[model samples]
Target: MSQTETNRRLITELQSRGLRLLDESAGAPSRRGGAGPSDHKAVQINGQTVMVPVHSRSAAVSPFEAGASGANGAVQLTRDGAHVGDIRFPEAPRFYGLQTLDGVPYWKIAQLHGTDVLATTVLQTCVRYGRRDTSCQFCAIGESLAAGRTINRKLPEHLAEVARAAVRMDGVRHMVMTTGTPNFTDRGAALLCESAFAVRAAVDIPIQAQCEPPDDPVWFDRLKAAGVDSLGMHLEAVTPEVRARIMPGKAEADVEQYMAAFADAVAVFGRGQVSTYILAGLGDSASAILETSERLIALGVYPFVVPFVPVGGTPLAEHPPPDAAFMRSILQPLGRMLAEAGLRARDIKAGCGRCGACSSLSTYED
Candidate 1:
């Protein structure tokens, strides 16, 4: 295989099967139980930072394992006991040590994703998360909060303070502010707008705000006016049956609602700035995912398809992530479709799709 193809396959395999570290200290702190990057760790392979499953059940028995770290901090990786190559873990962000004036730790308010992308959950509490029947089976959004690792609600001022420090001390390039769905008609858009406005005022970093589609389309303009450069309204599953079965509460929004919202968001954020996350391992088939990606691309929305690695405490904790073959079937074609549509992750200003760390689809775009 060519070098590019090798990297693509390697990344896909690592994400699907996960990587087990012989010594936990060799890897950076693995994020466990949170709104984003849950049960995973950021690993830099071939100079590309990707989030791989390191705490999932699959990882415990994964064929790939990281051995001892070299003098230069590079760790040797072995697949099924045979050495594959060396990989490095990102140093913990320097801003993590700072605290707000009110005595809250900065790390609890916002966390770093990938190498330089700073991310935070504006509102950790969600209306649907309180009930098992209404919750997304794959979600562990409440885990971090219950463990006292994060505050239920992050004040806008605290967010601004932490964001500024992250940019100044760690050289963070962009910020992603996502919120749990709130009960109001505006959903979490209102909170996101308030939070994004504060962060933008404190620092000039680009921001991506994520929330469920609001009841009214006018909120798109409101979000743009608040200095949000990108928007993400995720559609975790494409097929209605799968959505309803997997996430009964979120499925209530329906595909039609998401489609309309995507159009409105694209108009405000521009073509490539509007994006949605589509987890591939859920019940949706590869064909179903590709169909959704095609329609999303036509609507000027970037569909970020990533493997669904189960979180430790979620209902689907034991559920197996999509195998490498299954993921490649969806991502390879989806990457071509994105390139043909003139949509690329590198062009995105800020967001999960732009970070492209949780998925290898970005590699296939070439």
Candidate 2:
């Protein structure tokens, strides 16, 4: 196979099958405190950073696992004991050890994501998380907070302090500040604007802020004026049936509302700068995903298609991730659609889709 094809297949397999760490690699940094699966470990394979599940069910008997023996700090990746490739683990960031003047660890404020981006949940608590019917079934947003790995709410100044330190100590390229929905007319836009403003004053890094569509479209302009370079209003699942089933409370916002918000957001943030995340395995058909992608691209919103990974503690913990073939079916054409529309992730100013490590769509972009 060609190099691009090889990479695309390898990434899909790794994400689908997960991987097992050997005894020699016991000390590799593993994700413990954050949203989504806390069981993931970031590994660099084929010169790309990909987060793989190492502590989930799929990992226990994954066909691909790191070999016990290797030399020169390189580990051999094998599928059923046959050599597949080589992979390396990324070390923990230098900023993790540092603390603010008040003694809170810098990592608690923001953690390194992909290779060079810093990401954090500005408000760790979600209003819907209190009730089972209203919560996003796959969300683990509060798990990190309950474990004391993150603070419940990050003060704007603390976020600014952490952003400055991350850039200076580890060369963080950009920052992603996402929040659980707070009870306000602005729907968390107010806090994100305040936080982004503080960070911009402290550092020169680009920032992407994510939240639901606010009650008023004018919040988009306010967000732009606050130094947010990009905006993300994640749809997660496109079809109303899947959306209601997966994220009941969130789905109440309705796709029409999201579309309206995307239009206004694109006006403020520009075409490729506004994006939405669409999880491919959430019961949305491939055709459904492509249909939504076409509409989103038409509105100047980049559709970030990612494979669904089940977080361990959520209601859907036993739910399986989308098969690799299923993901390929959506991403391949979606990549072409994005290319045709001139909406490549590289054009995005900052955020998860730009990081593109958790998903392999970027590898397929032409």
Of the candidates shown, which would achieve the greatest TM-score relative to the real structure? 1
lDDT of 1 by residue, 280-310 (tens): 9888999999998999999999999999999
Writing each residue's lDDT as its tens digit, candidate 2 over 1-366 gives 898799889998888878888853443367763663367878788788877878767778799888654566567899999998888776678989899999999888888887789988889888898898999998888888888888988999999998998899889999999998887478899999999999999999999999999999999999999999999999999999999999999999889889999999998899899999888787999999999999999999999888887777789878888888998998899999989888999989899888988888898786
> Which runs in model 2 stand beyond 4 Å of their true positions?
23-28, 68-71
Model 1 reaches what TM-score against the true structure? 0.99
Global lDDT of each candidate: 0.93, 0.86
Candidate 2: give the clashing pairs: none
Every model's TM-score? 0.99, 0.96
For model 1, the stretches where C-alpha displacement exceeds 4 angstroms are none
